[model samples]
Target: MGIRATAVACLALVTMGCASAERTPVTSTAERFLSAAGEGRGGQACLLLAPEAARSLDDCEKQIVSVGLRAGAVRGVDVWGDEARVRVDGDTLFLHRFPDGWRVRAAGCEPRAEQPYECEVKT
Candidate 1:
């Protein structure tokens, strides 16, 4: 193959490798966010959010950190198409599976229409 063709082929291979969800892909990127939050890296955690969720709040990372919610593990993931809900430490999180990946819509949450994010974290 020509140099240009070879380079393109190599690029494709690299992309495929980087996009390796071949074996046991994460249930959702929300899990990664929780891991990040648990480690107290709000900015990194905030990066994995659903667009609407991202837009719904201001100063996303700092706001999360302010809530004294470092992070929690996703005990379960219930995915139905683009939307998914996760359970963590008795609290639940809402997420959306975007074209790119999953993002958190709400955290420290429960399925309560009246008070979704009422599971306050200790400061």
Candidate 2:
């Protein structure tokens, strides 16, 4: 009886740890997106897209490569429910949740007074 109770408690602890842990599923998703961007794999980046954007962005894989964005050095990831914001340098990339995973809604950078520095369409 004591061993069974201990086993149950351990399982519960593992479950809780998996949920609130810093590197939760959202974080992993964010990391993968950034890593693909770092490698200049736009098609892979598309894989992270919220459905509509993914469909729209799929055609232009070269754009992803040409942007010269590097994702491997991400500073941090902020997760708020189904939405997560990934910080690369000072820029913030936005994403939406999907049954498949996370998809990019927008990729934002600082110095808000922009000059079309961002291409809203991944294409």
Candidates in order, TM-scores: namely: 0.62, 0.60
Clashing pairs in 2: 48-103, 49-103, 50-103
- Lowest lDDT block of 10, candidate 1: 19-28
Clashing pairs in 1: 37-70, 38-71
Badly placed stretches (over 4 Å) of model 2 are 1-19, 56-58, 111-123
lDDT scores for all predictions? Answer: 0.63, 0.63
What's the lDDT for residue 123 in model 2? 22
Backbone clash numbers for all candidates listed:
2, 3
**Candidate 1 structure quality by residue, lDDT tens digits, 47-101:** 8766666565577677666665544655776666666666867567776666776
